[model samples]
Target: MKISANQTKNSLFQKIEQVRHRQGKVRDSHITLAHGSGGKAMRDLIDDIFVSNFDNPILSQLEDQASLNLASLMQQGDRLALTTDSYVVDPLFFPSSDIGELAINGTVNDLAVSGAKPLYLTCSVILEEGLPVETLRRVAASMKKAALKAGIKIVTGDTKVVHRGAADKLFINTAGVGVIPKEVNISAHNIQPGDLVIINGELGNHGAAILIARGELALETNIESDCQPLHDLVETILKVCPDIHAMRDATRGGLATVLNEFALSSQVGIRINEESIPVREEVKGVCEILGLDPLYLANEGKLVVVVGQENAENVLSAMKSHPSGKNACIIGEVIPSPPGIVLLKTAFNAERIVDMLVGEQLPRIC
Candidate 1:
């Protein structure tokens, strides 16, 4: 049977109408104070955007709080892992990702590094009055997509509208919950001498991408934010090395900060060779021109893991097999002397202490 073009068009329109009927569309083109006034406008916006995109069994119930079964979670681990982060990236949308995905990945990584299987998340967003509704739609869709990819659910959320100029267009806060397996016990205090320091991927991609996105330096590059979920990668590593000592997602303070933290917490010295660290040329150029250290720049999808010597090879090989950990390498090793310090061995064969920075070079990069 041959279908007419008119029939196809009518079918498409019918589908669109069905969606609109199920999830009412926001009548306003832009957000207003009324949308956050706890009235009809608020209901419409939530039903049309967030609820529609983040549709799930729990969220669809539209309860004030999402309830989870403790028995189901207990099957995965004995302890719960919870992490919260706020994303105020200067630009809500950037080269490869937006604040929505950043919020999801940041919280997910925080839990993943602790050897947990992420379960649920709560997203709270504040939108400035006069902001375009389309922007919010895109963000909501991104969050839903990211949550699906990470195999987690955004069970509940809140929204608010602030006066124009009082807010930076949008700010999102997220709280995540996960379950740590009974056999896994990862912490910075587990670090020991002869342990290896390994990173999952190239450092500073996110910082460089945001810097280029801002167009502050009048420079152009192919850098894109390395924003992604790392739970899968963590699972891969654990499959091969269950006794992993410590793990941390290198975020705002970069790898240097994470290394310093591990060193200080474990009271052991960490020495990283400059040559072993992987950094893209674009990031190196940006850092050199601005007199900034790439080690101190932020990374959204990078991990720093310290493993004992016997399991280092297995962990490195396991990580390399995973996409997120393709660039995994041992940048340093733990030492007995010079406790509570991190030293970087430069390309010129000189050693210098790597200290924690009082501030981040790229603020609001998320």
Candidate 2:
């Protein structure tokens, strides 16, 4: 049988992806502005590359709007949860995700970690004057798709253009509103000494992927930003266990920063099993190569959940069954022994203090 040229190229690309995935390396030499332009290049990039790897029903629809039914939303609460975030990821585009998607996911995750059902969002963009309009359209469309997938609506938006050097091609800011049941009380102060510390998935992929994509560090590994909106995952978990003590999305400062904040807020110590934490092999390699610690890296999609010890298993199970929570695990537990301290039990049978980031390690990493 003979295959068409497109098929031949796709097959070759798939084979290349297979090897890269197995070895954890990206073959792209560098990113060009054309990749963002909404033309054949952009479509091919999304279809032949990103969709091929991160394919999902929500993302595959490739539609202008994603229809959602919110008939049951009213019963949750009368008050709404609101959050806003700005994406200034320097390159704008990275291995696994881009700034537009990050803006949506970050804002949605903020509401999700707060135990809210995300509903509506407003997007504002700052574009370099010289940037192609097509690029802006694709990003806008991507944001629309992401919002739809998360069952949220982008009811309003604004766009502004800056001088070429004033902005780095593009920056996206989003504000989101969500509703939480009045009875659902999840807060840092609610955490207890006996509560368990759970993480939804592996850490540090986003930071390291950004580093590699920009060619800042020379390392051979296949990793991409674990960027996704977590509202659905949060919804599923809350439905099963509404009594979650506290939740936080480990973003700019990774697990250590969030843990430290939680520890201080609850006036309790946290003891984590280093061995229990999940770190992808490629991410580990990148961290080792760059002399970076995964604990302090940024993550856009993953969350830290603190629940009663007895409910830990149920929460982990609930998270694991969800697509976003496949690698969810119990990494640590709260304790009263050392108030406001985060202790790490190393794989080598040693203990160390996990401190908050004093200064920036990866500046502008977000």
Candidate 3:
């Protein structure tokens, strides 16, 4: 028997689905320069890569701007925190995240770690002339969704086109506004000897994932970037231990950089127990194979908290309740030692020094 018109229509739809599915296959080891140009290559990159990984309602909408309705009550305080960062990842996109998501999270994390509740954000786009409009839309859409998840708004933005060779395919600069409650205060200068060190979760995942995505180092691991928003987690910690001495997000310089900065700012030393620090076996193995130090590896979602000794358990309890902080642990403490130094206690009872990365290990990674 001949197929009905309805059945013919159904068959056509199935054929279209198969065609779309075939467009996203990843055969190349690295992103070709064509991936950024707003053409067939760029469309494939966004549809197959970004959307597949960060599937969400706001993202699925694929609109020029994400519709949001933030509560006015959330912006009560006169005190506010503002932060900005430029996204310049050499590869632009990585295993777990791209410059788009990183730009959002990076600014939000800075505000969160500073005890501010982020509210509004402004994004500036520098697009290379040949860049595809579709890719730009995808990135803007990602920013909108990330801002919504962080409870912030993309209130204002600007776009500028640059000569093809003058700039990378794209670079994003994001600035955020946040309200700081009068009662909450987190500062590196507030750190004191005898305070305890608590980390939100495992380190090196974001860094390791970036290195692998670059395809330079031949190593394999399941580590994906831990890039995420941290406002909710920060809020919980503040609620339980309102007297927290200091809080910082471990980003570019990793735990070592932030810790050393804190030590210097507070004029104190930090003693970290090697056993207490959390590291995934996969990340550790990758680090070992590459001769990279986990301590200096970057992290996106993780946080470092220094709280008074009496409130350690309270802060830890708060941290554990949040998804981002489920693996939180007391890693070390502030101590009276040589000013601005961080000491690591090894598994073999040996002491070693940990310092800031000289320049950059995995460069252009957020």
Q: What C-alpha lDDT values do all the predictions have?
A: 0.92, 0.79, 0.81
Which stretches of model 2 miss by more than 4 angstroms?
1-75
lDDT of 3 by residue, 171-199 (tens): 88888878888788789999999999999
Model 3 ranges off by over 4 Å: 1-75
Candidates 1 and 2, the one with greater lDDT: 1
Candidate 2, residue 204: Cα displacement in angstroms equals 0.6
The parts of candidate 1 lying over 4 Å away from their true place are: 1-24
- TM-scores of the candidates are 0.94, 0.79, 0.80
Instruction: Give one digit per residue, the lDDT tens place, for model 2 in 1-366.
Output: 988999999987986775345331223333344444656544554454344333434434555543433565567686678889888886777886787788888998999888888877766666675675556545655766776688776655444556668778778788887888887899999999889999999999898888888876656567889999998898888878899999999999899999999999989999999999999988888778778899999998899999998888988999999999989999988999799999999999899999998887687677
The superposed Cα distance between candidate 1 and the true structure at residue 365, in angstroms, equals 1.1
Listed per model in order, the count of residue pairs whose N, CA or C atoms clash below 3 Å is 0, 4, 1
In model 2, the clashing pairs are 24-221, 24-222, 25-221, 25-222
lDDT of 1 by residue, 113-171 (tens): 99999999999999999999999999988998999999999999999999999998899
Give residue 211's error in model 2 in angstroms: 0.8
- Scanning candidate 1 in windows of ten residues, the lowest lDDT window is 15-24
